[model samples]
Target chain A: MSRKYAAKGIFLLLLVNLLLCIFYVSAGAVNISPADMFHAFLGDGKAEYQNILVHVRLPRMAACVLTGSGLAVSGAVIQNVLQNPLAGPNIIGVNAGAGLAVVLCSALFPYCYAVVPFAAFAGAFGAMLFIYALARKTGASRMTLIMAGVCVNSLLNAMADAVHILWDDTLTSAYGFRLGGFSSVNGKVLLPAGILILLVTAAVFLLEKELEVLTLGETVASSVGLHTTFFQFLFLLLAAALAGASVSIAGLLGFVGLLAPHISRRIVGEECRFMLPFCALFGAFLVLLCDLLARTVWAPYEMPTGILLSFLGAPFFLHLLLGRSRRRRKKHD
Target chain B: MIRCENLSAGYGEGAVIHDISWEAAEGRLTAIVGPNGSGKSTLLKSVIGQTSVERGGVYLEGKPLKQWRHKEMAKQIAYLPQSRNDASLSVFRMVLHGRFPYLAFPRRYTQKDEETVIRELKRMGISELREKPVSELSGGEKQRAYLAMALVQGAPVLLLDEPTTYLDLSAQMELMELLRQLVAEGKTVVAVLHDLNHALQYADEMVLLENGGLKQCGTSKEILQSGVLEDVFRVRIHILQDQYGKEYYGFSSEKRMRNETGPAASGHPKRLQIRS
Candidate 1:
């Protein structure tokens, strides 16, 4: 039953994502016609059109898709592993952790771009480990883990702020960094991080059954022969890697992680096999549309994509919060 | 057979059950009964390696629990928790997870696995509810679905904790009958029962516990004859004969008394708290 729903949902999502991709590529700052866009995509258009398609538009589109899908899937995994609806990469400071490393590396190295992605990965992994260790030491519970994530998030954000203040002169993209945008994305960083995200996301898809079993709760998962603690850590590690890779490319894009998976859960149901792919496509589509709006809304005066995401995400968060409580009240009465 | 040797276990540093030793014999229904907070559930947890064992360990078929891989152990013993998630999954999919232990890498379900799930669902009389969400089922139907899931594990032994809690009388009796059927089919079954009458009437063997200690481990007849139920539970036990000379166990608790002269003394209807 889920399979049929997933198949049709995936088809529609793919079609929407494909249309959005074409619109995103064609309707940018230097608008290209459909015929010219097709010719340029095939690498034989007018020189200027081809150059814009290859250098500026294509890379930016890639950045949005990668950042969107990567963050969304990571959020889904974190939500499942932590067994909390509100938990996400951004909520738990994973993006902040990666952002801190990127800022510190850029500040210290100044010109060396190769080390930023690795530094981001290391930082994200470290923050996740710290939160888990704190929760474990305090006798881990669902509440304890979320509390630890809050503390770690605040601490990491504070450190990132300190770095920004200290290296105000050296870092040129400080403003753009806080308000994540694709205006200045480097293909050099995008390539490696994009590959990492794809590999990690594929790995998550392959292990969908294990993930589904984990959602049955710890006792049943163990009773069914899953190594609960090991699987939990493994998934958290994957989530960190994804958040790290995404932050490496697109600064600190929040809310896609939280919003995409949540909306996907409603559309595709909770089974990971269907939900994972649907989430990836839906997330890519969301970012594509949002980035398009960010670019074209105030043409010649681009808004940061993250600002648009926050506008959509913040209210959705409150709605979920209030709706959940209302449902609980109804259940009680 | 399942055995616990000098098992002392708890959640963390504090031991809830201490130095307890008992064995659930093969092809028999062993009911672990005690008052609340007497470590009845803790003992069940200890057997499944959910708790921290401070001193001893559990054994399955003469092998220490630590020696068996988790998947292998799952193939030998199935457990039904007292509380379970009402996951928003279809009943067919939920029951299919019973074949989880046998799945290999990538963990896709096989044709045989699906067949087994359908067979178990039909056997539990829940085939009509296959497409329904597990969370939407009634209490009795939900329990049946969970039981079908456990049975599909194909384990030789089964363990349950408070399987009848929150269940209506008919539902409780139905579940108990199902457990008896499983035991009669040559499966070892262990359950922690809150109702002593159910324990006394349904179980083949009884392990009476009090204050985290094993008061006695014997046949139901022997435990009833020993009179430990009255002492531990602080109740009066009565045996009545039916028309065909069949014995039925009844209980009267002083805890619910409302007057000085109880039902035994004044035959006051309101003062009587008889459970049979």
Candidate 2:
């Protein structure tokens, strides 16, 4: 049965995720041995190992998994709502909006780190509404939505750049945020981000059936008693919250949103019930793997995982575009 | 029964269907026939609240349509839009979506829901194709799958827009026969059709629309006898009776009488003709 296969696929993905998690946690800067990791788990490790495990590695790892899963799941939801394979938080201005808000918050408040995530969520939600309005005004075609998102992204990024120029003290952090990584993440950022992702992800799961009906197109969905506009708005808001939380933790991280959901779709077809969990695990594995490579590949001179992801994601994006066109041609034939 | 009281609806500024008052009788198959751009689909959409009704209202079972909640309305009336996209859903999953109005959120499909889907698929003669992806099915098979989805909704009133658009002749006849069977089972069936002969043969009542307004609404025999279709479609029609006394209709563009004499211009030159 398809259900059995889906269960097995989810299990395999979770297993892979666990393996990557261990690999990431053990091979970090301090290079904790497996024995030390076990000791730390048992609360019998040395002070140095315990400090590194609890204070440093755990938060960073949690940030990686949460950001990755949040972005990918948001991407899947946005893609279904918009009915565009290329739709993602990064491509649709959600991440850019959140990043811009964070930068502006840092510039304006200077010392209020607590306000950044809230501001990011507000900015992302505002950007989504603006894009939806523009799309509706222009008939809400797929191309118009993407174009509006691209324009909003450019405008918000330019504003963020202006803020950086205006506040010299925020410039260094803003630049680091722009080239996203987990270098500066701590429990302060991880806790709220994790909670937000968990809540929104649960909501998305509850909407799995609606999302499936939505994929058939708005008219069909509405005909089946679904309040299409209301559900679309709710799902978009959830997606924005997920993107905003991820951006709050890892600044402007791109491609995981676009890539992980796509890969999950290939593995699990388009059923959201299976695709959502698969996307979470695959996304976590991807980011954890990328983070591990970023740390180990250059050793002392580490690269940002976002940069590594873009390097891998651009070609994958093109492949999707080309494959879609080819399939369309085949359909016509 | 579904009734519209001077309903005017469209996408945006201008109304596509203007001030049309009509009713589809219960336990009968009604067909709406119109030429291209005559707003047949828009009229059906207005009934299901898919279009913006700029003026007037629609009623279902004596209650204003807007007063009914979405799930409640869906339980009363099932709608099948013109098949456009080739969705990648499996036939079984597609039919399962019809149970959406009945199932609460976050609840899995119950055994009863699955039984209904399977029964509908069997009725559609597509039980064997249940696990197949809908996108890979033939056009007739896909339409049947969509029909199965609509049937599983278990609504008393069914509205279908151009259900036979992409079907071949036999498939079209099969679907029409299936609709007639649904009507025989006491469900109200309404469809927008282009083929006048099929509408005449299968429908109990016919509603003709032209230029966004209702042109005629009567029994199929009455509409045929009135000969309003020729004027509405800008064509000449011939109603023929075979030896068995079965009535059929044929259509041709209005013939032109040529002033100049030529071998090709003898009598009335037949332009394009469609014979049923």
Best by DockQ: 2
- Over B1-276, each residue of candidate 1 has an lDDT whose tens digit, in order, gives 689999989989789998899989789999999988899999998888899999888998888888888888889988889888777678998888888999985568899999999998988889999988887898878888888888889999898888887678988998899899999899999999999888988999998888888889999888787767777887767776666666667676755542544643322112222334
DockQ of candidate 1 compared with the true complex: 0.66
TM-score of 2: 0.94
Candidate 2 chain A: worst 10 consecutive residues by lDDT?
A135-144
Clashing pairs in 1: none
Backbone clashes in each candidate structure, one number apiece? Answer: 0, 0
Residue by residue across A133-187, what tens digits does model 2's lDDT show?
7776777767567777888899999988998998878888887798888888956
The residue pairs found clashing in candidate 2 are: none
What tens-digit string does per-residue lDDT give for candidate 1 at A142-229?
A: 5567667778888998898889888886457877887788999998899899999999999999888888888877888888888888
- In candidate 1 the C-alpha lDDT for residue A97 amounts to 93
Q: Candidate 1: which stretches are off by over 4 Å?
A: A133-148, B254-276
Please, what's the RMSD in Å of model 2? 3.4
Output the worst ten-in-a-row residue range by lDDT, candidate 1 chain A: A135-144
Best candidate per lDDT, number?
2
- What are the per-model DockQ values? 0.66, 0.68
